[model samples]
Structure formats: structure tokens, C-alpha cells
Target: MRGLNKVTLIGNLGKDPEVQVLEGNVAVAKFSLATAETYRDKSGQPHTSTDWHSIVLWRGLAELAQAYLRKGSLIYLEGKLKARHYDDAAGVRHYVTEVVGEQLLLLDKKTGDALPPAT
Candidate 1:
């Protein structure tokens, strides 16, 4: 049997994307996104909860992120979920989950912002 690992999120960026060029001049960008959900309890009081997600973009997407994305920008992204573990200097193990974005849409574009390059 085959399996799938996909995620789609619509949220606001928590901060500007941090871009780094890896060995071989491959660009990578990392940032956090905040998604909020509103729900009502039995008493009818509404509450909102926000979840933060780590997002990563590679190559062209990374370049686009650096050029266009900013804190509080609203976007829609589609990607795959990746989970990894690493050991810190103290030998303590840590786990992280991230979304490797393959497609992105800028939802809060204003009249003056620069547009992405044409295909």
C-alpha cells in the first residue's frame, strides 16, 4: 500500500522569513505561521486558539519568500510534513516537525507590493 504526507495551511506569518544559502548556493527560508480557530463552549462564550507551525521553503520558493513574505502576511501553503530529531550539545535529544512548502499563495497582497516573477 502507498501512503501520503501532505499539509495545507492558511495563516498569518509570525515573522519575516529567514533565508540562508546552503552549500551549493541553494536557498532555504524558514518562518513561523500562526493559525487561529474560534470555538464556542456550551455556555456560548467564544474562545480563540492559535497554533504556530514551522514552515520551510526551498530554491525558488525560498527566493520568493525573501522577496515578498513578511510578518503578519496572510498566505496559503501546501506542503509535506517532516519530522526529525537531533541531539544538542548537552547530548539531549530534541524533535522537530516542519512543513516543507511546495506551493504558496499570497493572500494579503496590497496594491503596491511587488508581485512574484512570471513563470
Candidate 2:
């Protein structure tokens, strides 16, 4: 059986999406998202933790993100985790894990216009 690699997150954008076009005219958008969790311990102490995740969207999804999403915008992202490795100028190899988003939903409420459908 093939293994499964999936991730789902509901978080706030840490910054605006950075869109770039590749040599093949492929659009790629990158951004950071922060998810916070709060809990109370047995001793009546409250604890809160925030985790930061790197998110990447390609093609049409990238375009949508660029148009609508902004810093501090709440969003729901569904995707898979991907790890990439590359060598830097110093000849050192580095590995980074990123969430490759396939589906995105804007959760922020709009004032005048209706939100776009999920892509």
C-alpha cells in the first residue's frame, strides 16, 4: 500500500504572499502562516503556543492568493508536506520542509464584496 502524506491547517498569514514567475512562466507563491493553540493545565494555568509553517502554492492558486490574501488574513490550507534539498553557494546542502497547498479557503470576513470561492 502506498503511504499518505497530507496536512491541513487553519492559520493567519504572517506576511503577504510573495509571488514569483519561473522561467517556464509558472507562478509560485510563498508565505508564512502562524497557528496558535491554547490550553489549560491541571493546575489552572493557561498555556498558549504558536507554530509557524511555510506554505507554497502553484499556478492558479498562486494567482488567487496574490489577489485576495494579505498579512494577518485567516485562511484554511489543505495540502501535503514536501521536503526539498539543495546545495548553497558555500557547497553546504540544506533541507527544508514546506506545505504544498492544493486547496485554500479564505476565512476573513469581507465588508462590501463577497469572498471568492475556494480554489
14-118, model 1: which lDDT tens digit per residue?
999999999999999999999999999999999999999999999999998998899999988999999999999999999999999999988885747755532
Please give the CA lDDT of all the candidate structures: 0.92, 0.93
Report the C-alpha displacement of residue 82, candidate 1, in angstroms.
Answer: 0.1
Residue 72 CA displacement from its true place in model 2, Å: 0.3
Q: lDDT: which candidate is best? A: 2
Lowest summed lDDT window (length 10), candidate 1: 110-119
> Candidate 2: deviation at residue 12, Å?
0.3
Model 1 TM-score, all chains together: 0.93
How much is 66 displaced in model 1, in angstroms? 0.2
lDDT of 2 at 82: 98
CA shift of 77, model 2, Å: 0.5
Query: By how many angstroms RMSD does model 1 differ from the true structure?
Result: 1.9
| Superposition error at 116 for model 2 (Å) | 3.2
